[model samples]
Target: MEISLEKPIQQEVSVTNTGDLSEIQRVLTELLYVPDDKLKLVVVLELLDYFKEKFSQKDYKINFFYTKQNGNITGFVVSQIDKEYRSYGMKCPTFGWLTSKDFLSCKLLMGECEDFVRKHKFRKIRGPINFPKISGGIGYQTEGFEAPMLNGVAFNEPSSKVLEYLQELGYKKDAKYSCVEVVESNWNKGNNLDDDIVLKFLHPHEIRELRSQILTLAQNSFYSVLADAPGGQSRFEEMMDSYDLVFGNRFVIKDNFDPRSISSIPEFIEAWESCDLNKIVPCCPLAYDRTNGELVGIIMALPNLFQLWSKEPLTHLNVDTVIINKEYAGRGIFSSLQNVGQITSRLHGFEYVEGTTIYANNDRAISTIFPHSTPLRTHYVVQKRILRK
Candidate 1:
């Protein structure tokens, strides 16, 4: 299949299924700024190989388009179509996992995608998804391009002009996403928290208890968070696991007067004799009702840091979550918890603090911790019509 566009040179493009992996990879590497050693490319190749095998069964179809100049390959676009979800599937055949840096060549590739979808009787096209859902699915619409191009998410760094051209050709913004950054020093200095709420290091036993609660809270929060940000939960867990490899301690704040001291290693050991060697510290916040002596609120902090755009590691105290019963709202429990996180982060050598929030959340967090920090990135929920009918 081939298409030509009328331009200064009258470029002719050919779309084909050559089953040529190396040739495809060569053009792709040239068009995209993918680093030679990034593991994302390895994952991409694996996905492609899996697709190739599946297409052999005739359950899936693969398409490729190349812009050739005198038979030398200038660029290519690859896409796949699956027939499993006929009802909800796009009107045009959906094709994605596309990458190209060459301006005009990339445009031609997209045009070819539209042509393929039209020829196949597809109503619309959507993708770059690693594989169709009928197969072992391996992507999230929100997963790619969450970080900078250098950080290794698939399909990052497409040229803006190319995107604009696609939009002009009838694609629209389907999603918006963001990456927020907060300098530790910029965190709110107002520690005007309730005096009864106490901030303390956790004992080994206490750490274990908090860890159990954290797991529960994280799991419960995942669905609600995903309603607004589809892939945040999985990514959050992966990030936390990575952090656990670096800092094993669990930190918390409490209302108890007798806070555990870091020097009391023996006492900690006695309390958690069966604890894994990996578990070291417990840092959390606790709030108590003076009369009832009941644990009213708990907040946990774990070390989380990100490599900045400057390539410098910015260490910050990250609040995984703060749990307070609904009855405790507006009683300053949340404020106290965040204060503990801020103070503890500074003491622990962190230079920044950051967390994600959904649009529906109250803006109190922003006003309290980051009045001026720019919302570094904004995420969106994007949609496109599948072109193959």
Candidate 2:
């Protein structure tokens, strides 16, 4: 590796393998706020261990870059090529590295990453895809200071100079999604809710009965939001599987929702039960209108306890999905269902709820959730072609 700043200095820039795990940890610790004692760091180490076990004997390449002047280290970047998906079923060729606050070194690091991918014969790239969304993405570009950086999404508080420099280097806006925080203090306490819409906390037995109904709602509403990405159905299935299907303790199902009517519920439940629930904590779901003796809508909440390294625990809640029947849309039933879910979150000690929506969602979620909240984070999905044959 050659190191050169504008106006060209004679200092040698060298690229090396991340031979010292401690050094890597140190660099990342300086960049991110994750505690050394947290399970998140252990999870990251476990992921690296998995990569080593799977790819160490293969043709995979992992390297790091360091800039030194007069034998003093000032900056570094880590890069690795994985032959298999680490997690979340993503199989793209990926690179992860760190760069100093130096502008030229950052540019050089990104160029080296692109070159490495092209040399390895990859056609496209998708990342800074971190192990979990909570660990910020590698390729994040920050624009303004008006908003705080979102936990879990890709982010960096680069100076305005760095932003202009990165744009001149060829990265562009990829995908934009908002992360909103709904504090417990913001709950709609004064608005009178409908008496007929009853909220029930589901147990394992009721979960078994309503499991099929929940899956029906997930699959029906699937294509409406996730139709564009690669293997969207598989990704959705994997997410559902993470909750152990219907085993999440924090799940809400509408009353008397018929599971038999939907075809995918049985299989989902069967798959969910086969996993070890001990590794995953059960989330509470708020099932609405069960007392009305009819099934209408189901809202499920998955507590993201494991990703606490990204944000404070109980400060954020990832709304797994809110499924409402098409016939129940115009009657304000969805609002009622959401109210129950939010209130349940407050009772359980959660401060905010977050979820994703595609370009086609027609502002249904935004109109309902954003008016009373602050934006926490934003994510962009960018793609680029490798100029190789």
Candidate 3:
């Protein structure tokens, strides 16, 4: 009788560029899906839909690449090239939605990304940064794996070995971010701001009326400090649109007081009445020039609705964005706006306040925004240097 021996399973890794979103979604869902968790899945699918919409619009250069192992989809990454980033320096494209089954797969997929970078003559590659500003996030999860995933925050399996693989593949840390939580007891009630600065909770009508001003404030406040400016009216409107769908009229305007008493504007009353505070406490607090009514600072936060989706008590408020005009930087506007939002959240029974993606080097955010708070989770944005041909 002839001796029979079974051959070992061969390792197969292949990467391809495709427009098939369904396949992309399948791979991502398989990687991220949690049983009995509909909300997280919905958010994931919605983000993919946003990518699809953007692709259809052809507004930006978005490329999708996926890797297969032994004929099974095992990894994927999306590379986005923004025209505006070129003016700042090199057209360093951002790679996001990175998911993979194993370290080998991860390395190979990133190899494909690097090849794309080389082919395009881009100077560097950065990310795991998703986009649209409103729904995207930066970096890979390096700490706090036990913490529940928040909406718009990046997620990675602690055991995936992806970060390690990146390090081995010549990626270095470009930036670090922190997610922080502040409890009611730690509320930093700010010192008195200048008399000419007026802080108030912006009503819905006021938000609509002041949309242009708010966008301007965002652009002016964030342009210098951030890599990407908030840009033109269309981008700001896109963010607002995302906020509306994500929050679902749950934003708390001023207080529990009668709507008519707070605003004479009919639209304001109707909008305020539509909010269901029992579910979540969301607010937009603003500091504006008392003299000219120009916006000086702003803070926006919404309930941690991910808690509800996880079947946990909704007791957390998430501070999404904080912007203080450069001219008014040291006027305590940042702290004051946060204090007001925290007070409002506490009054409505929230137990903790969380802020996401605070850059490690942001001295102003660290010193002024939440001085004493420690990070709940930490993330690192990685980059690779590519030599020009």
Candidate 4:
């Protein structure tokens, strides 16, 4: 029951699929504390379903590493086969790591990780995925902590110790991303878009029908950068559901009309000094290929603040996603989207807008987003032994 790296990892420890839901909820609530009770339940339900699938199949594993004597759960993770491994005809499959909590020993956790890697003879361990790439993607926020709350924007922030452990085990940056912030200003305007591209707002009722269009564009937009990587359609689909649960209108945050609109950072801070975050306003705009009637770009935004009820205030809005088809890149499509987001957010009285996640090594995306916003925080998608020698 008690697993120690100091002991023989094989005999003293074992990885099992009997991860009870109650135990997981305890660990998640204790360590993660995803703020909203409803959201937390949703997350738990999702995790339960995720573990069920992984454990039921012989080809899968939902790893729960614990102390054998007391049956105390100390570490947890999950993984499954990936398309890349199957396509490559490799014996070492790509497994998406699930989660680990508590102040579990770095050596103990890493030993389990290596064990999982070896058992499946996995080519690499792609992780931090909420579950599988088909449902979610990999990520760990590394900055702007202390919100102590979670909503549709960013979920639970993992402990710095997790990153430390991964680094010690020689885990490399499989993907690096940042949540950039853009203060409300006149500079990043919507006029930057190409003349032929027309921006249209998504009707609340249009989500189901438009999901396909958006998905197609999203797939095309992310293919070069994240097609082989995690967090694509699955991530977007999850966000769509979040839009219904967290945001009032099922598409936008409610109307934002605070009389004390912040004009400067100092003003914003002053407003933050005494304010209650009540009003919410979000904008979801899409750019269509005027020539072919095809959807090519999208920009989704929402009113957001860490620690929802804190003095933090809703001065800043979160840009959930910005995707433009690859064939449409470098055409000011993204810039135009940013501009529109800024204008819409500013009009709603938000002093700023931010993106919670965007890959760091994606120079094209970084360059495109840089002109419209400033990087506020960094998050890493840590991975190891994916590509074989």
Best by lDDT: 3
Taking every candidate in turn, the Cα RMSD to the unseen true structure, in Å, is 9.9, 9.9, 5.2, 8.6
What's model 1's overall lDDT?
A: 0.45
Can you give the lDDT of residue 149 in candidate 2?
Answer: 34
Per-residue lDDT of candidate 2, residues 260-322 (tens digit): 443233322322243332222334434355456555666655555444434554445665456
- TM-score of candidate 2 relative to the true fold: 0.56
Residues 1-389, model 3: lDDT tens digits: 98769786976788888767787677667665332356657666766887788679766677788888777787888887765442123446778778777888888888778777887777788887766544456778878777656655666667767788788889988788888876433333354557787766544444556777776677666655564332446444554554454443453444556756633534233434555443332357677788998888877665555665566766766676788889988867777666655655564556667788787777888876566565688888888887755
Question: What is the C-alpha lDDT profile of model 4 across 309-359, one tens digit per residue?
Answer: 343545555666677788877787776666554655554456756665676
lDDT of 1 by residue, 176-219 (tens): 43334544432233234455544344444554555544444444
- Candidate that would win on TM-score: 3
Better model by lDDT: candidate 2 vs candidate 3: 3
Candidate 3 has what TM-score?
A: 0.82
TM-score of 1: 0.48
Q: Which stretches of model 2 miss by more than 4 angstroms?
A: 1-9, 17-23, 30-98, 137-151, 158-163, 183-315, 318-337, 354-368, 379-381
What would the TM-scores of all predictions be? 0.48, 0.56, 0.82, 0.68
